[model samples]
Target chain A: MQVQAASSSRSAQLPPNDPPGGTHRRAPEKLPRSRRRLAPYGFLLPFLIFFLAIFLVPIGYAIYISFFSTHVSGLGLGPSQTTTAFAGFSNYRQAITNPSFYQGVERVLGFGIVQVPVMLIFATILALVLDSTAARLQRFFRLAFFLPYAIPGVIAAILWSFLYLPGVSPVAGILHSLHFGTVNFLGSHSILWSIANIVTWEYTGFNMLIIYAGLQAIPQSLYEAARLDGASDFQIALRVKLPMIGSSIILTTVFSIIGTLQLFSEPEILRAVTTNISTSYTPNLLAYTAAFSENNTNLAAAIAVLLALGTFILSFGFLRLVQRRSMGVSL
Target chain B: MTLTTPKTPRPPTSEPKPVRYDAKGNRKQRWDRRSVLTTAVLFVVTVYFISPAYWLLISSSKGPSTLYNSAGFWFAKFQFGKNISGLFSYDGGIFSRWLLNTVLYAGVGAILATLLAAAAGYALAKYEFKGREAIFWTILSGVLVPGTALALPLYLLMSKVHLTNTYWSVLIPSIVSPFGVYLARIYATGSIPTEIIEAGRVDGASEFRIFRTISLRIMSPALVTIFLFQFVAIWNNFFLPLVMLSNQKLYPVTLGLYSWDNQYGQAPQLISYVVTGALVSVIPLVIAFLSLQRFWRSGLTAGSIRI
Candidate 1:
C-alpha cells in the first residue's frame, strides 16, 4: 500500500513552486530562518510524541521485558524475595513450546485461511456488482452494506451471539419451527466458523468499499474500449475491472490477514455464552491470558512479540509475492 | 459516453439485431432483464447485511416471557419502551455511564487524533524537510502493527506508570492513529495546491498562519474524513480497553455489555436489558453514519485510490 502511495505521488508530480529548497526563499519574508527550519518539526511534534509514547515505546518495552523474568526465592511472598533477572531466550522458548499457544496460533491460521478468502471474495463480488452500471439505488445500497461497519465489533458480536442462540435467534427459531434438529451455532465444532461469520458481517462492507473505490477510479474509456472489442459486461468485469483493482484487492487481503491473526473481540464476546471458546482461543487472547490471568508478563511479552513478528512476516511476504508477480506481468 | 455509442453501430455476426440492440440499450438508458436481475441480487445482499440488526430491533421489543415464547423476527408485545427503561434503570444506570464513557473516549480521541494527523500530514505533503520520508515510513509501519499485538505491552507500560485502569490508558493509545495520518497525507496532497501556499508566503503570511487560515479551509473535507475514520476506529476498538481497564466503572459500552453478557446465565432477565442496551448503543453510531455518509464515502475513496 505504501509502495502504491509512493508511485501515485510520483505520478502526481510535485508543483515546481514547492521545490525542496522552497523554504529557503522564505528568508526574505518576516518569518525568521531558525523558526522556519523548526516549523515542520513543530507541526509534527504532537504526532511524533504520541507515536513514540504509544507505538514505539510499548513495542520496545515488550522486547525489553521479554528478556527478563522474576526469580522467586524461598516462599516468594514478599518484594525482597522476588527479583527480576535476565532469562535471555527462556521466555521465548517457553512461549514457543507451549501447547496452548501453538493451538491458538493454529486456530488463527486456519481461521485466516478460510475466513480471509471468503470475506475478500464476497467483498470483491459486492464491489463488482455495485460498480456495475445496471445496479440501481447505488447510494442507498452502499450505505446499507456499510452500516454494519459503524457498529462496534463487540456489539456486532453480542448481536450475532443472540442470533446464534436457540431461544433468541430467528435462524434457530425458524429451524425449530420447521421441525429440524437443533443446531448449536456456538457448539465447539462450529464456534470458529460462527466467529468468522461475525467478523465477515462486520468487515465485508468495509473491504467492499475499498475495492469499489478502486473500481471507480478506473477510467470509463477502458470499459468502452472493452465493449468496442465485443466484451460482455461479465467478461469486462472479469478481465478489466478485476485486474485494474488488483492492488486494492491485495491491500484488503493484507489487512484481512493482519485482522484475522488478531482475532480477539468476537470470540471474547462469545466466550460469555458458551465454554467452547477457551481463554487462549486466539494468539492475542493467549497473550492476554498469560499476562493477566497467569501473572506471567514475561511469557506474554514474548508471545506478543512473536505474534507481531508473525504478522510482519506474513504481510511483507505477501506483498513481496505480489510485487514479483506484478513485476513479471509488467515485464 | 460518446465512445460507447460507436460500439453499438457494429453488427455482431453471431447475434441478431434485436438481441444486439437489447444489450446496447441495457448498457444505455433502457431497463432490461439484466438490470432487474442486478437489482434483485443487490436487494438480497442488502437484506442479508441488515437482517441481524433488524432482528435486534424487533427482538428487543419483546417482553422476557414473550421473547422466549414467540418467534424472534416478529414483535410479540411492543415492550421496547419498558425494556429501554429497564435497561437504563438496571444496576443504577450503568449502561448510560458506559455510553457516556464511550462517547468521551471515541469523540475526544478521534478529534485530537484528527488534528494531530492533519498537522503531520500537511507537513509531510506541503513542506520539504530532512528525514520526512523516514518519518512517513515509520508511521506507515505502525499502521501494519495490529493494536491487539500491543495490548499486553501497553498494559505493562501503563501499569508501570500507574495509568492502567484509567481512561488515559485507552484514550492515549487511541489518539495515535497512523492510518489517519496516511489518509490525511493523501488527502492534503490531492486537495491543497502548492500555489496557494506559495501565494500565502508571498503575501507575508506566516507558515502556521497560512496553515490555519487557508490550508485548513481547503482541507476541511479531508479533515472531516479523517475525523470520521478515527471516530469509527476508536469506537470499534476493543482489545485496548479490554486489556487496560479492569474496573466496571471504566468499561466502554462494548466491554460493559460483554461483562453483563457473562452474567446473563445467572440472571436470565438481564437478557432483555442486554438486547435493549445493544440497541441503544448502536443508535448513535447509526445516526452519525447516516448523517455523515458523504464525508465517509469520500474518505474511503480518497484513502483507497492510490493515485
Candidate 2:
C-alpha cells in the first residue's frame, strides 16, 4: 500500500528526462513491484500444478476409491452385470482379516525385529571406527562403506538375488567345493533373512554416513576435558558421545523405520528368484497384486489409503513420542 | 564433531599443574595397543561390507556353466565381455534397453528434480511474500511421507489421467523432492547474501536477471549437491517404478534384472548376465560419488558449524 502511493505521487511530480528519454522511470519502477509479488506464485506454479494434479488429487481419489467396491451380478460377463459402488469398511475389513496380509506384517516385523537393530549397531560401530583416532585412510574407508549405497536398490537386489541361487551362487559353488554342502539362502525360512541382508548391505553405508556426521559434530574440547578427568575413551564415548548424538540417532532410526515399511525392491526381486515370496508378501506387494493380477484397482486403492494412514499414524506418532521424550528436540 | 579423548590439555599453561601423563607410560602403551585394535576392527568392518560386492565382480567374469564349478570369491577365466554380450543377445537385447531406460528414468528425472527444487528453494529463500513459510513447511512435511506410501496413489492418478504406461508415470513424481528443497533453502540462506541483490537492484538489473546472473552463480555448488543427491535417489528408486510400470520394455535395470533373475531356473546363463549387469550398474554411480565428494566437504563443515 505504501509502495503504491509513493510511486503514484512521485510519477505525478515527475521531472521528465531529456527529449531523447521518452519514458518516466518512477511509475514503471513500481509496476515491477506488483509483478515481483506475483513472481513467487509463478515460481511455485509448476510444483503446485504437479502437486495438485498428482499428489492432492490422488490422495482425494484414494479416499473416494477406498469407499467403493465392485458389484458383480450373476452371469458377470456382461457390461450391465458388473459395476463399482460404495462399500464402506468392506475392503479395510478384508485387508485386516486376510491371513496373507497378517503374515506379511508378521514377516516384515520379524525382518525388522532382526534387521533394524543389526543395521543400527553395524552403522554405529562403523561410524565410531571411522571417527576413531589412528584410523588410517579415513576418507578411503568412508568411501568404501558409502560405495554400496550408490548402487540402486534394484541393482543391489538383482546382484544379491543371483548370489542366493543354489545353481549359480558362488556361495553354493564354494560350499560344494569344500564339501560343506549348500544352504538355501532364499528358501521360505531364510528368504526373510536374505531380504534383510540385501537391505542392510544397500543401506548400512547410508546410515553410517548420517551417524558419522553426528559423531563428527561432537566438540573436541569436551573429549579432552573428559580425558583430563581421567575417563577412559570407552567411558567418554558411552557417557558423552551417545547422549549428545541422541537426536541424530533418532533421525536415522526414523528414516530407517520408514525405509523398512516401504521395503519393496529386494523382496520383489527375490520373489522371481525364490518361490518363497508369494504375491502378498508385503502390504505394498499385496496392493500391487490386487491391482494388477486380481484386477481390483479399488481394493488396491483402499489398501493404499489405509496403508498411508497407517504410515502417518505410526511414523508421526513415533517421531512425536521421541520429540516429547527428547523435550522438544526434533530430527 | 566431538571425539571423547582423555584430558590431553593442549593450551599454553603458565601455571604449574600436576600432570598424570608424566608417569603414565603404561597408559600410553595401552593407548597404542587400543589404536592397533581399533584399526584391526575397522579393517574387518571394511572387509565385511565389501564381501558381497567383491563376490559379484569376481563372478561376473565366469561362464554360466562354470559358475557353480568355480569357488565363490575367486575370478574364473575372463568372460566379462562374453557375459555382457550374452545378456544383450539373450532375449533380443532387452537388457540393453532396460539399462537405457534406467538411465533415462534416473538421469532425466533427477535433473528435473534438482532444477525444480532449486527454483522453489531459491524463491523461498530470497523472496518475502505472503505465506512464504507456509509453502516451505508444506514441502518440508513431505519429508516424513515415505515414497513407498505415496507410490500407489501416484500410480492410480497417472492411470486415471491416461498418463500411466508412459515415461510421465515414473518421471513426474520423481521431480518433487522435499529433501532437495530443504537442502537448497539451507544452502541459499547461508551462501546467498541480501546485499548482492540490493546491489543488483542499484545497478538497474532486473530481479529475474539478477537471479540468473548473480544468484545462480553463487548457488552453483548447492545446485550440484542437490543434483548428486537426487541422482543417487532416483537411480536407486524402485517402488515408484514398480507400482507405475508393468511393461518389461519400460522396466529400469533393477526391474529388468529382477525379471531375468526370476528365470534363472529356466536359463542358468542369465546368472552371468545378471552379475555383469550388476557390475555395470555400479560404475556410473561410483564415478558420480568420487567426482562430487569434494563438494561434500563443505557439507560436512556446514554440519559441524550449523551455519
Candidate 3:
C-alpha cells in the first residue's frame, strides 16, 4: 500500500520514469486458467523501450542541444579553431527575436485564425446531419466524407498542388475556357488559402467521423422520447445533440490547435511549387531552414524546442479549457 | 444519466423516483427539424466535396501542350492511356520507381508499426504489472507531440547511427506510435476480457500464447483500425523521409512529385507527369479508406464514452 502511494507521487515528479523499484505492481490472475497473475511490465516492455529511445531521449537531447553554440575564433580560417560552448539563452534569444521566426508565426496564425473554425464547423454540421439519418444513404456519406482523410497529407498536398499548377491543371483549363481568368492559386497572395483548402478537405472528413461517432453513441431512445415531447429537430440538435457532443468538439479543437502550431508538411512541400512560401512560412519550416540552410544547429534546436514548447502549452491549455467547459473535468 | 434498470421490475414495496433529467421528450422537436435539414445539407455538401477530385480526373487526361490553354474543370478528352505512357516513359521511368518506393514505405512501414502498436496496446490494457501506467502515459504523450517536432531529432539520430538514406531510418521511428497504442489500449480493454485469459491460463497457455490466441483474435477490429491509422500516417509522411533520404532511388511518391513540381518552371512537361502521378496517388488512399470505413466508428473520444 505504501509502495503504491509512493509510486503515484513519484509519477507526478518524474513523468517519464517508471515507478521506482518496480515492487508495487501485482500481476492480474493468469489467462486460460492458472491462478498466477500475469505481469504487465513484461507485456509493456516493447512500448517502453521504443518510446524511451525515440520520444523521451530525443526530447532530452533537443533541450540539451538548445543551450549551446559554436564559436569561430579569429577570422575562422580553419575548422579546428571553432569550438562549441554553452551559450545560455543566446540561441533561444536569437530564435525568438529572429524576423523569419516571427513571420512564420504571423502567417500561420493568420491561417489558423481562419482555417480551424471553418473546418470544425463543416465537420460538426456534417456529423449532426449524419446522426439524424438511420437512412440508407447516410453510411455512404459517412464513408465518403472520411475518405479524403485516408489520402496521405503529402499526397493530398501533391494532388492539390497538381491542380494548382497552371499548364497541367484541368481546373486551370476550365477557368481559361470559361474566361474566369486563371490566377495562381499557389501564388504568394493565395498560397495560404491553397494550403488551407488542402487541410480543410483532408481533415474535415476525419473530424466529421469523430463527431458523428459521438452523436451516434447517444441512445436512440432519447430521440424517440424527444418525439414524444413534440420537440423540433433543431431543438434536439441544439439542446441534446450539440451539448452531448461538446466534449468531442473540444477534443477536435485541441487537436486543431496542436496541428496549427506545428504546421509543416503542407507549407514545406508547397514551397517547391510556389515562390511565395519562404524559408519561414511556418515555425517548423523556419526551424528546418535554420538547421539545414543556415547551419546554425544550436539556434535551430532552440527554435524546435521553442516550437515544441508552444505546442505543449497550447494543447495543455486547450485541454484544460475543454474539460472545464464541457465536462467539468479538471484536466 | 438515465435511471435504466433493464433487468429489474418496479419494486412492489416502494417506487423509486424517475431521474430528473430523463425526460428525453423535450428533445424530440429538435430531432425532427434536424433530420430534414441535415439530409438536404449533406447531399449538397457531398457534391461540393468531390468536385475537386472530379476536376483532377478530367485534367490529367489532356495532352501537356494544351493543358494550360484548355478548359480544366470539365472533360475535354480522355488521355488516360497517353498520360500513363508519358508518365512511365519520362526520364527513364523515374516516376514508376518513386511509386514502387512509396508502396514499400507505406505498405511495409504501416504493417510493421501496426503490429508493434497492437502488441504494446495489448500489454497496456490486459496486463497489471510494475510501471504499467508509466508506460501507457509515455505512449499517450506521444500522440499529442507533433510529428514535425520529431523530424530534426530523428534526422540527427539516424545520422549518428549511419542509417540515413536507408529505408531503416524512416521505418524504425515509424514503429513507435503513441496514437496507435492509445487506440490499441482502448480496443484491448473492451475486446479482451480477463475471464478469457484466466480460462486460457487454466488450460496451461503461456502469456504470449494467451495473447496470440484469445486476445489477438478478439481484438481484430482494433488491429484493423490501428493498421489504417498507421497506414494513413505513414503514407502521408513527408518530413522524416525528406530529412533522412536524399537519393532519388529512395524517394517516395510524395517527394518525387515534389521534386518534379519544383522544376516545373523550366520543364513544363514535368507538370503533366506530376499531375498524372498525383491523380494515381490518391487511388490507393481512397481504397485504404473504403476498406477501413467500419473500423473508424470506434474513435479515441468514443473509447472514453464506451461504458
Q: What global local distance difference test value does model 1 have?
A: 0.81
Ignoring the other chain, what TM-score does chain B have in each prediction?
0.88, 0.84, 0.84
**Fnat per candidate:** 0.67, 0.46, 0.50
Across residues B90-151, which tens digit of lDDT does each residue of candidate 2 receive? 88888888889888888888888877877787788777778988887777767766676577
- Model 1, B93-202: lDDT tens digits are 88899999999999999999999999999888877778999999899888889888887888888898999999999999988888888878877888787778766655
Ordered by lDDT, highest first, the candidates read: 1, 3, 2
Model 2 chain B lDDT-worst window of ten: B12-21
DockQ leader: 1
TM-score of chain A of 2: 0.85
Tens digit of per-residue lDDT, candidate 3, span B1-307: 2211111334423212222123543442344654566667777778656766776677788766666667656566667788888888888888888888888877887787777788888877776556778767767777777777777877777788898999888777777778778778777776666778755643445678888888888777677677777777777778888888889888988888888877778887787777788888778778767655656665444343521
Q: Which candidate is the best by TM-score?
A: 1
Model 1 chain A worst lDDT window (10 residues): A24-33
Kindly list the per-residue Cα lDDT of model 2 for residues A1-331, writing each as its tens digit. 3334543553454434431234423333445557667766776677667666656677788778878888677774555566888898898888889898888777777777789889988888787766655355566777788877877788777777767888767666767779886778977888888888888987888778767767766667677788889997678778877777666567667677777777777777777767888989988788888888997878888777767776667767877887788663644
lDDT tens digits, residue span A134-158, model 3: 2225656776687677667776777
- For model 1, the TM-score of its B chain against the native B chain is 0.88
Worst 10 residues of 1 chain B by lDDT: B1-10
